[model samples]
Target: MGLLTIVTAAAVAGAGYVRARDAIVQRAQDNAVIETTNRVEQLYPLPARVFDHAALERIAGRVSGREGSAIAYGDGISAGGMDPSVITGELRSLVSSGRVGWQRVSYAGAVWLVVGMQLRITADGSSRSSGVEVYVLRPFTSEIEVVNELARNAWLIGSAVLILALGLAFLAARGVLRPVRELQLAAWQLGQGDLTARVPVRGRDELASVASTFNSTASSLEHHVGELTRMEADARRFVADVSHELRTPLAAMTAVTDVLDAETASLPGVAGQAARLVNRETLNLTRLVNDLIEVTRFDSGTAALALDDVDVAEVVRTCLRMRGFTEVSASLPDGVRARLDPRRLDVIVANLVGNALRHGAPPVSLTLSVAGSVAGSSLEILVADSGPGLPESVLPHVFARFYKADSARGRSEGSGLGLAIAWENARLHGGTLTAANRPGGGALFTLRMPLGGDA
Candidate 1:
């Protein structure tokens, strides 16, 4: 805006100055030409043919009565208050050839418009040069003053226009930019989880329209989010209540199954088979119930770290031994101690290695190593197998609860929540669990736990 104003002002001022200057110059030339022609006509035939000093002075006085003075000279006679040098050579040449001519020249530290004309002699029906000439020297001082005044006015007006334009541009920018800045800050707050963030709308301009639309969208988002949060809380409460209600009966059933298991070998064919299957199913039911309760605890945010400084190698070995994962290969580095929940670490290891042993072929391998320096150190546990790798379609959902890669395997021996629970535990420790395919073959599960107290 400012640039456009400057260019427009400069062009207008330049054009105004040019026109004023041209008009003044044109007026000065016109006046000089008219005065010289009229004086020559009045002194026609060159009074007395050849002039003495007094007669020449009379001709000078007649020609020079206007705002400027003049000179009249013919043969060896000349008279005037102004210098003859004010008439240029070019003007003198044209006039000496019996023509009236004019020119502008610099003279005596100022500009002069000079007009010269030679007297013509009339004889019979023809005319010829008489050698008597009159030259008028009109000063341009007043015209210069007029031009200077116009130029000064042009500068003053152009500057005023530019300043006014700048003031208007500043106001327009403030009106637009303040709203835009508010919108930006509100958007940032919304992204940072402030659902109540809103911008103030003013006027009925385009900026106001945009702000209104953003407020409408944010309000809808807040409404939907409120509904979802309430529903989620209710679901968690339902699961927690149901799991608690079933625990008592499940404990009683476990006691009955244990007694049945001991007497299974002493019973007859069908009863013996029935008792064994009942015992096995009761144990599986107990495991599933426990798993569901653990998931509820995670969802309710009641899960916490019970940190103990312990040897990581011993934890892994004990988890493997307790789970009868004896055939699995292990690379437990010596004396890698960390402040961690030892029970949670054991659960993480058991889930990953157990999944590998069940889903993959031996030689399954568990590798433990510390990554990064001591202050920022992290413990990484890698469990890999030599069977088929995870399907590409299943990799993205590998840690999702109850997500089975093969649909028919939904009722498989292992509960589907193992990886999900493991992931939750890793997150609770401020770490991560990831699954991938080994470069060589089969599936890989990696667990990383940060070492510092901040974890």
Candidate 2:
């Protein structure tokens, strides 16, 4: 827009300058012609009285002295200071043919007005030529100076107009784009989850209307989101309450199931099968309840870390040993110690290794490493299994509670809360738990914990 304005201004300025210059030149030319004609009328009568070259020279000299001009006469000679050759042959011929002629010429770095007049004598009955011509040279320096000054002023005024127009264009663009920039920023904030973000209303323009509409939309979104948040909180509280209430009955059931498990081998075939099923189901239910409590603690922000300087490799080994994972392959680096929550770290390792053992192929591997600078270091634990890697559809939701990837598998083998619990425990220790597919065609889970003892 600024460029367009400058171009348009330049074209207008150019046209104005041309018109002004032409008018100035025309006025100067007219003034010069009028002054020359008046001088010729005064001098023509004196030249007609004389017939010889000497008398014509005297008359020409008198005219030069009176008018402060240069005068010449005859074919190519002059009595005054001017040269006869300065007058062109065409102007001389026209004067000899009884016609007045004038021309503007440049000489000696100054503009000159040259006029040609024929001297005529009225005899007793006829008018006859005296064979003498008068040519006047008048310098129009002052008029040329005036025209030049006008040209300079025209350029200066045109330039100022162009600059002022450009400045106004810039100001207008700024005024228009300011509201658009504000709207863009408000939209970005709203996208970033700031439901309270809104633009300010200004004048009663289109932009103001847009700002008012935006504010209204933001208010509606905030109200709806507030209601949804309240409902979600209520649901979480209900789950926490139900899980807490079931603990007492589940404890008694666990005790009864333990007794049934001890007597299952001595029962009859059908009864033994029923007893085993009940025992397994009771254990699964107990694990599910515990997992729910743990998740609630995380959701409520009540989960905390108990930092201790412990050997990370030792913790990994102990977790595997407690779980009776004898066939699991392990790679440990000696003296790999870190400040972390021992209990949470144990849970993270146990769940990852246990999941691999249950769902993945044999020859599961565990690796431990330390990384980063001395002041900001971390411990990384990698657990990999030689089983089919997770399906693309299941990888994203692998840590979601009760998310079973294989629907064909009944609920007898394991609870689906293991990975989710593991992820929460890692987060409680200011760490991250991620799952991926190994290069050799298996599932890999990585646990990274900060060594700075921060939760």
Candidate 3:
């Protein structure tokens, strides 16, 4: 826009400069013509005598020798075979009744103002043929020089005006566009899930109004986000309280159900069958409630890590043993030890193995390796399962709380909070949890934990 404005202004200024210079030059030419006529009338006197063509030519020659004169003529006959004169007798015959007029013409590449006048006077008390036609010419070069100088100055002034206007227009455009750039950046941040983005109000104009509106929108978004976080916290707290309350009754129910199952061998009726179903369901319910309470504790920020130097290979074997699994293969290095909370490490391994076992095929591979640091080590604990890998849609949000891959397929025996809790535990230990599809066909869960005691 700035370049366009500069170009337009220059064009207009150039055209105006040309028009003004032309008009001025033309007026100078007109004035020169008028001045020449007036000066000729004042400087030369009309002669009176009965002169022939030769006498008239001699007198014209004398007058033409004067300064600022180009051509002069008289009306008479010449001596060369036929009568000859610039303003000849035949030409004078055409002006018998009145004085002749003058005209402007070009000669020798210069403008000339020509004046022709009929001279009439009495000589020796006799009105003889003494009047002659006289002409005087003046050059307009001096006047043209003045006009050219004025045109040069006009061009300079026009250039200056154009440059000034262009600079001012550029500044105005930048001032208007700067705030728009800031607003664009703020909007980009907001789209990337940064709700705190806002623009500052600068003045009491339309742009300022826009800034005010943007700030109001950001404020509303922040308020709603805070409200949602509070509601989520309350919901988790309720789940935690309810799960704790169910623990007492579930413990008693588990003991009673166990006694009934032991007497199943003595009975062969519907009552024993119903008792076995009840016992199985109660045990599943107890595990679900325990998972819920653990997740709630993590959400409420009450979870803590008790760090200790422990061999990672032992941790993996212990987790597998707790789930009644023995045939394990590991690529754990000898000194692959980590400073981590042993109990949380157990939970992370348990959840990852349980998830893989349910959704994947057998012969899961567990790898514990040391890399990246010697003094303050980093451990990579990878659990790879042979199953259909995670679908693309559910890969990114696999660690989100209560987010099931296929909710309509009914919940798995392992609660959805398992992966969520594992992810939280990894973060608490200054680590990260990642999942990806294996090359052959399966999914791999990797827990990368920082092994420094400070973490």
Tens digits of per-residue lDDT, candidate 2, 161-241, equal 889988998898998889889989999999999998989888999999998999999999999999999998898899899
lDDT tens readout by residue for model 1, 161-277:
878877888898888899999999999999999999999999999999999999999999999999999999999888888888889999999999999999999999999999999
| Residue 405 in model 1: lDDT | 81
Per-residue alpha-carbon lDDT of model 3 for 389-449, expressed as tens digits? Answer: 9999999999998788888755536567889989988999988899999999899999988
RMSD of each: 3.3, 3.7, 7.6
CA lDDT for candidate 3: 0.73
Alpha-carbon TM-score of each model against the true structure: 0.86, 0.83, 0.66
Q: lDDT (CA) for every model shown?
A: 0.86, 0.81, 0.73
- On lDDT, the leading prediction is 1
Worst 10 residues of 2 by lDDT: 43-52
Q: Which stretches of candidate 3 lie over 4 Å from their true place?
A: 31-145, 152-160, 163-223, 247-279, 297-302, 331-333, 371-378, 386-400, 403-412, 436-443, 450-455
